[model samples]
Target chain A: MRDIFDQIRKRMQPPQWASWQTLIFLSIFSAATAALTSQAPPQIAERIISSLGWVFLILGTWWFVYEPDVKKKLKIYELFIGPWIVGALICIYLFGTWEGRAIPAPTAFVSWPPISAIVWSIPKFIQSDPKTKSPIYTTPTPANRQNIILVLLANLLISCWFQLYFEVQDWLAEYPSFRAQGFEQSAFVRELQPPEKRLELSRGVDYLDAAEKALKSQLEGKPWAEVERWLSNLDQEFPTVRDEAFAQLSRVAENQLWNLNARVISDAYDLEMRAIWQGPSARTAEYSLTKTCRISQARQVSTPEQLKFNSPTPPALSAQQIRSLGTVQCGAASSPDSLPQP
Target chain B: MFTDVLPLRAILFQLLFIVLAIAIESIVLQKYLGIGQKTSIQYAATANLASTVVGWLVFFTAESSLPPSWRVQLIGYIFYDRINSPALLIGLAFSIFIGTFLLKVQTINWLDQILGIRKPSTVEVQDPIKFRGRTAHRQTFSELPNRALGVLWANAASFSAITFLIAVRTILPPTNY
Candidate 1:
């Protein structure tokens, strides 16, 4: 064992091409640099070189693993020793992650080694000319079938890792309220930071605000006569208003995850809008944020024509005053306890 | 970013557990089976690594194939560190514990067979295995044929050590870290 260590030390070289260790270090360094540079703007050369370093790591490790052992490389010995080292490190992300479909651009940097290991199996199964980069016509070797199975299994794991990353991100984005909760009950995850330090995700409040504004714009500043007409025919008008509400929101809402309902109660003099969150949530019951846009008009009995007239100087009028054509005033969201009675 | 969200601590814990297992298993094998230090270490490391690799594979399969409702709990566990129910977590943990123990035991047997390693006769290596942690070291390497009983003892020791470690980590004030 001591002699083996000494032999490896003697074989170690400074340049990446001459030694696998140097190549591994270089690959790791380049991957770190790329990850750091990605946070800001990266230079074209830096990006290219960082990407190329991974390629070197892949090829270099493959060469070292297979080159010395073609004598008995296909046997169980090479299968365990060579790839296991690289695979152990690779397992960090693959095993720790919950799920993912495939390697995205950023993940592909450190992912090159296992991928190279997978690619190495190809030649073993079917002969290929390395220098010419041409496939030599040959059937997949039955003796090396395990190599094919191993590669397929590796890819399957990689897919789950990437998929899980995306899944977690999506889940958190939807249920921000769950972040503050304790993870003691969880075996897979835990809260590292306290509740105060974590980000405050506006839980459907922003959506409600958008919906209110949408309703106000649709109802406010209209001629009193037209306002009265539209209010009476809310069935015909509510669809467009609701559509506009959702249009102001994110495409991710897609009218399916979120639904905005707007209605004017003539008896109550309220243009109430409810933005119920139908998206993924920790709660069994969904959260519904309500914004009641008070429908008001000036105390003065202004004629329809007079109401349309522009006033150069606006008066400081509260709910007591009613001078404009009509006003749909919106304030903060109301509790989701119950819908207001019409 | 996804990189920022990576479970680096989990990976570190796993590596730490492997090292601890290898050490404990080597000690058990070296003392009980009358094997050389290097030989015992080799057997312990090989079985641990193989089991770990397979454990990850099983995790991926179960994760991807999870139903929609269970997937929600999985996401919650992965991201927010919360699970709505403890039943799933408990069941999953138990299964993994038993699965890994079996895998480790089988891997040792497989290595022994494939490598044509010679084991001492029942007369040379004879001792009873008391499941208790205190007497386990002294209790025995059983009269049964292969390295099965020895591997079981080793795996059990390693699992207890890892479980204690996990309990310690979980008990620590999360904010302090």
Candidate 2:
């Protein structure tokens, strides 16, 4: 084991081509740079990472290809490496962000490759031929130049396509109904809802249905003039219920706006008044008339109990309907406690 | 189920990755295969871009198929919203690396052919110097095993690097509240 260790140590000794001091310095610098960047703003960290990635690529290329075997440096630091690094940093500055914490850049992987080529091409670029001499740099030929442009165009096109795809996906999700009249809003609201939610939703639907039916039946054959009067009287009589009464009336109008079913809705004036009064609030007749109703004192009216006693006979209605109507407009049937007159 | 729609930030991140992967692959092609730098870049752009999209689709599929509890755990791991189970993270990493590797290889080959790089010469070449080295010979892409190994190595290296970077980010709590 000792002998093997000795052999490994001997083999691992620095090569003639490598500058040990420079390598150590660069490594430390890179580490320190990364550590410092860890706390920097995300944008700064991103740029630093991009730059460090390039630096690593440069070093890796040097260690693997140009240094040990060649026993000579590429020596194109000023002409190629420096400029490439600067250009790369600038590009990254413009395009890179750390917010996504995603893959840094497309060129990140290729950073070393281009640098390697440039290193190899330096000698060719600098002079007519350096075959007999040590090559320091690689040349960028016309073909290389054209290839660069084409590659750039290709990348741009791919980016545009990706952006388009992303936009389309977002659009589809944002307006799910764009595909078709998709499920109603209620369907979406109903997802993952508790078991009891079905009951609640049904109850809401029932209430809306009842309210709508009451509104339509009350406004079936009335003129707009009559509706206006009923609504105006409602506003004066029960200001709190007026908005709802008018809104429901408008819905009825709009529902039949362009249809043959459209008609000037009218109903019994007193019935309309009673329904509007009983529709939401169930105040006693005297309390409702005195405090809420806008009708004049000249109108001959009496409480349902008083009317029941005075009449010889009274109309019939179910207990539920009477409770719903909340008035004696249907005569004896509207009073649950009173016996029918013979 | 998680919404199929990707956030803008997430899409942008994928785009950035695609760009980086293409650039790196192009450089590798140029340096190792003697392909013109631009041609290599163009090939890389198409290959990497396709691979990125395919990778996301695969990831989405995996995520969607996973049980809801598992998906939530995975998403939690992804956002560092909670401490991640090592087992889950390892499994996720393995799947991601493998998925990316497979898609990348297939895409590269498909795009290479479509891009008219059907049979590039891969003549074995030695280093300029006759000395002891870690890697002495460069085999052409024509060698199927070598190509596979090369692609595997690249993908593994990239995946490991990214995983390490992400782990670091996870470990270091963001400075901003």
Candidate 3:
């Protein structure tokens, strides 16, 4: 080992031709691999190729540049490059799926660390006064800047291409639906209704309408305290009315208080109110009637519950009663609880 | 004297190793592990970027890649991805960047080790009154590249194990099947 080291020390230096040869070999290997695979290669193979490529490139360059004598050169090659070559063959045997059986194409550009390292080391090796404190050669120079730009562009292009390809496939798969109703409309509908059945369209529309009415009343200069009162009454009359009231308050506050930047704060308040009102029992008619009455009073009108009780049954109430009964079983026959008669 | 000129060969070897490592990682190791193409690609890209950038920075800085400030900043940024809604993509991106940077740093150090590149320890002339004088006194340490190599090997090993798991998953039919 000592003799080998001494010999390597004697012959250590790289030739220019070797760099070009290495690059060529890499290109060929990449091309051959891609040709054989005919598609994006597997992950493990790609990683091994990339890692081993870097290792060999650096080690080879080190040996070619630094090894002084033939004995040293041969020894270094045998120790490092030999194992790599054998490993490559074994890897091909173990992992190769295709008949041609070549390495996979490299997705990235072929630049390696040793070249950059050497470029960086030049200044350190050449400067007469090591203590002069000059900037290291690794500092980006015009050439390096050009290289960097090239690399950056290549990476961007590759990434963009990959992204676009996947997006195009997704779009293509959904194109028929999009074409029938337009992309915007389809997207809007889809966003409103994921397949999980979490959102109900009819309920959503009703909630939106209630929200709008509440906002309109607020814009007409109804005080927040009045709105809160009306919302609380509404909650007592209509248990599910909290979402609408909160939505309305948020919309009105957002539009009216644009100058105050209070929209976020108001929205947060509304969210908190909704959380409290929508608590477990909000599904009860008692909770609903109380909430609706509170909101109606905040709107500075006679409570909607009074009007509702005086009039024939509101269609909204009938629907709400039906929904509540769907889940609650009342007797041996699982009968729904009847709405209280005024 | 020969050591002065062997950079070309070293560069070639490094390039070869990187490519091979990526291939092995993606095809053999990742496959066995049950990692799909997307995840494997992500890992490859991140590792590549991390290794390259860190290698360049360290070789130039005369330092190792494990400085506290850098670790805090770069690794911290990676951890920040966890909070994102679609975390996988961002996580992959962050991991790739860090992995590649580390790989590059390791590669250079590895070369230094194999080639026995040593820097002579000598005191530099300094201005006694200047605050910058202390900067000259700091000795730049280059860690052995084997550490970085070890990390890469570990990654490969883990990936390979994953591939094996995936292979087992596929080969052995499910009880339902």
TM-score of chain A of each: 0.47, 0.30, 0.20
Q: TM-score (chain A) of candidate 3?
A: 0.20
Candidate No. with top lDDT: 1
Per DockQ, the best of the predicted structures is: 1
Which ranges of candidate 2 are over 4 A from the true structure? A1-342, B1-6, B78-80, B122-145, B175-177
DockQ of 2: 0.02
The per-model lDDT (C-alpha) reads 0.60, 0.42, 0.35
Q: DockQ of each candidate's interface versus the true one?
A: 0.06, 0.02, 0.01
| Model 1: per-residue Cα lDDT over A50-103, one tens digit each | 666656566556556665554266457435456544443344333333245443
Better of 2 and 3 by lDDT: 2
lDDT of candidate 2 over B81-174, digit per residue (tens):
3434567657866877787777767766765554445445333333324644534433222332344455666565555555665567557744
The candidate that wins on TM-score is 1
lDDT (10s digit) by residue, model 3, range A104-197: 2222112222223333334333434368766434444544433343344333333333332333233323211111111121101112122222
What interface Cα RMSD is found for model 1?
6.8
